[model samples]
Every structure is written in structure tokens, then in C-alpha cells.
Target: MTSFAQSERAGLCDTFLEVGPDAPTLCSDWRARDLAAHLILRERRPDAAIGMFLAPLAGRTDRIQASLAQRPFEELVDTIRSGPPKWSPMALGSIDEAANFAEFFVHHEDVLRGVDPSARRQLDAAEQKAIFAALPRIGMLSLRSCRVGVVADAGSYGRRSLRSPKDDHGNVVLTGEPGEILLHIFGRTAVTDVELDGADHDVESFRKTDLGT
Candidate 1:
């Protein structure tokens, strides 16, 4: 079966084709071409990609990504469409599903919602299940700094209490579809559709916390 990761990759490429290289994306200061280049760089250049996690090497990663951005926009999108090169561990069957699903999904929305703020989509049962399955891990990463306890209320997918590294007495219940929840966790909170339920102070504190990117 074609995974949501693959589907999101294709959809992102299609959007890239539609919007062209100069199009805006939610990623700070990145155009469609730049975002495509980042994806390519991420999957194809491990040496440079290390900079993404390591602050000291970030300059090299930025320079390499900028160089890649100068390539033809169509070529960049095509490279992404073709999937990671064989040399990339992301090409492994399991890693592809585990890693790329949210990566592509969020970047895909970066394109779509960047063009139009109201352009969110609904996920099917399987798709929701896919995103829901990932919520716990992402929740932990995203909510670690939250002062109040965090609980994801993903409607039919049920709820998950996140691991907040520092917690006060209050709890914040984040209510939304899995995709919207994921988007919020990914630092797209301004555009995300999730609702927060908690004390005024707790909700405000949760809002003040930085989420994923």
C-alpha cells in the first residue's frame, strides 16, 4: 500500500508544480524552490544535514541548501518526487514511513497554507490513524518545555498525555483532529486549528511555549 508519507510527498510536489519556484511557504523566508531544496538536501546530503541538528555546522548546511536552491525549480521538485536517493537511509522501507509521514505532511501544508491560510484538509481514517500513531512521540518532543501538563484530545483517536519536562499543577487539553494537532506541535500554532482547554493561566502558558518546527 502507498503510505501517507509517499502520498504527501507526491502532493507536495504537485503543489510545487502548481505554485512554481517563487511561491511563498510557511517556512521562514523560504520560497517553494528553497523548501524543495531543503528537502533534497535533507535526504541526499547527510554530511550537511548534520548541521540541521548541530548548530556549529548549520552554516555549511545553509550554504549547500542555497546552492541547491539555484537549481531549476522543476528539477528540485522532480528530485523530491523521485524519493530519496538509494544512498540515503531514508530510502529504507521502514525509515521512509516512520520519518517522512509528518515531515512531508507538514511541508506539504507549508506550501498549501502558505498560499492560503484557510487551506487545511481532512484526513481519512487510515490517514488519521497514521498521524495519531505519531502524536505521542511528537507530543513529547513538542511539549517538553510546556509548564503545564499536556494532553492531546484527538477525538476518535483518543487522548494521550504528553511528557512535559517541567509541569505545574494545571493540565492543558489540546483538542483537534490528529493532523491539526500535529501541525500545532510542529510550530504552526498560529495557523493551526486546535483548541486548548484549561485554566486561563495554564492555557496562556501553553500558548506561550514554543512548539515543533
Candidate 2:
């Protein structure tokens, strides 16, 4: 089976090439060029990538990412298309599959869905399974502030708990294909098509929650 990670990478690369550098992304204040720089530095320069998560290091990270963004646009996009550097954790097959499946998927959507509001990708069963498998961990990052439990509806991929204290009644039951759920959890709630079922208060809270980047 083709790895979802590779598929997403290829798709994202193609979009980047198609759209050119100045196209906007769902990531606020970022364009395609900036996204490409982020992908490159995230894999090639661990020192600066830390800035993405570390407040004290953010300035350096921004400066480095800005520098990379200034490179020839095609070169930057090609670097992203070529995959991660050899020394990076993402270079390992297992790690790449496990770590980057959703990273690339979400970013690809960021580019695609941002450019075309009417766009929607129908993910296959295997792709949905991969996302379902990875949901628990990724959910922790994206739903850190969410108070409701997130349950995926039963389907070919089976049911999965994306968050704690799975309560079918009170907690939010997120009904959709895994890709939509992933996008919703990844802060694209306004764009992704998903069904949220829960008590009024819980659903409202879930709606207001900041599904972190």
C-alpha cells in the first residue's frame, strides 16, 4: 500500500508547484512560500524548528524560516517535495509514516481548501484507518483545550476515541470520515464537513474550543 505520508507529501508538493509561492494558506498570515519554508526547516533544521513550539526561540525560528522563504521559490518547493533530510527523524520510514501522515495531510488541505472553498477530498478507507489510528495522540495536541470527549462513529475503520472519558451521550460524537474529523480537530472546523452530536452545552463548548495548531 502506498503510505499516506508519501501520498500527502506528493499531493502537497504538487499543489505548491501549481499554485506558486504567493498563494495563501489556511494558516493565518502564511502563504505557500512560508509553508514550504516551514516544512523544510521542520525537517532539515531541528535547532530552529524548536522555535515553533518554544516561545523564547520563536524569533530565531521566524528569522530562519524567513530566510528560507527568500530562496528561489521553485527551489524551496522542490526541497519540500524531495522529503525530509537524512538526519531528521522523519527520514526513517516508520517515523515518517507515523509522524508525518497527518502533518502533510493537514497542510495539503490547508493549501487546497484555502484556495478553493468548495474543495473537498474524499479519503479512502486505508487513509481513514491511518488517521483513526493516529487520532489519539494528535488529538491531545489539537484538542488540549477541549472539554468534551470525541468519539468517531463506527465505520470501515471501526470506532476510535479521540479524547478522554468517552461518553456517547454527553460527550461530542464526531460523525464523519476520518479526514473531516482530522481537519475539524486540526482547527479547520469552519471549512471541514463534520457532524457534532452532544448536549447543547458540550456542543457549544466544543465549538468555541481552540483546537490548537
Candidate 3:
């Protein structure tokens, strides 16, 4: 069976082809071609991927990524679709899913929703469960900037107190599917359907805060 990470990677490649290189994406200023180059660099050139998170190394990473972006867009997408090479840790079957699922899921949506905000993917049951299971840990990291506390209500999957309520900030209830909630937490609030139920101030504060990297 194809893992969710693998499926997302394949689907993203197909989307890149459909939209073409110049297509815009939810990722800041990156076009489809640029996002493709970033993915390839992240997986194939681990040395520079750190720039993705660290500030000081970003210039080097950007230079390398720009160089990679100059490659034919389709070729870059093909490199991502083909999966990591044998020498990379991502090539290990045991680590692939854990390593790529959230990364691919978010970036996949970034590409899709960049063009059509309402284009949300309907994830499978197993995928939802797996993602829901990961919510608490990632929720903490992603929502670190939120002024209000969050309770993720994933319907039947379960509910989690993503962050403890601050005395002054209050708490917000985020009601939605695992996938939608994930997007919202990752600073894609405008495109997500996750309903925010809370006091007026809390809801507004939640929306105003920037979440995730």
C-alpha cells in the first residue's frame, strides 16, 4: 500500500505538471517551479536544507536553491517524484513516512490552494488518524506564537488541548477535520475551514497571530 507521504509526493508532482512552472503557490513568493526546487534541495541537498529553518544559513540555502530552480521545472519535479536517492536517509523505508508526511501534506496544499483557496484534499481514514495522532506535538510547535490557547476537536478521532490557556488570552476551540486543522495551525488560516469557536477577542487574537515557520 502506498503510504500517505508517498501518495502526497506523487500527487504534488502531478499538480506541478498540471499547473506548470509559472503557477503561484501559497508559499510566499514561490512559483510551482520554485517550490519544486525547494523540495528537491531539501531531500537531495541536506547540507543546505538547514537554511529552511535557520536564519544565518538562509543566504547559502537560497543561493543553492536558486541555482537548482534554474533547472528545467519539470526535471526538478521529476527528481522529487522519483523519491530520494539511495544515499539519503529519506530513502530508508522505515523513516520515509514519518519524515515526509507532514512536510508533503502542507506543501501539497500550498500548491493546490495557492491557485484555488477552496481546493482542500479529502484525506483517507488512516491518513487522518495518523495526522491526528501527530497534532499535539506539532500543534505545540506551530501554535507557539498564538496568544490564545487551542483545543483541537477532531470529531471522532479525539480532542487535544494543544496549548494551555493563558490567563489573559483565553482559549479557542478549533473544530474541524485533522487535515484542515493542520493547515490552519500552519498559518494557512485564510484557506482552512476549521471553525474557530471562542470569545470574540480570543478568536480575533488567534487569527491575528502568526503560527508556524
Q: Highest TM-score among the candidates is held by which one? A: 1
lDDT of every model, 2 decimals: 0.87, 0.86, 0.89
> Which regions of candidate 1 deviate over 4 angstroms?
164-167
Taking the tens digit of each residue's C-alpha lDDT, what string does model 1 give over 60-101?
999999999999888898899999788877888788988899
Ranking by TM-score: 1, 2, 3
Clash count list over all predictions = 1, 0, 0
Error of 1 at 62 (Å): 0.9
| Residue pairs with clashing backbones, model 2 | none
Instruction: Please identify model 2 stretches exceeding 4 Å from their true place.
Output: 165-169
Give the number of the best model, judged by lDDT. 3
Q: Among all windows of ten consecutive residues in candidate 3, which has the lowest summed lDDT? A: 92-101
TM-score of each: 0.95, 0.93, 0.92
Per-residue lDDT tens digits for candidate 3, residues 105-213, read 9999999999898786777888999889878878878988877999999999899889987769888999999999988898888899899999999998888888975
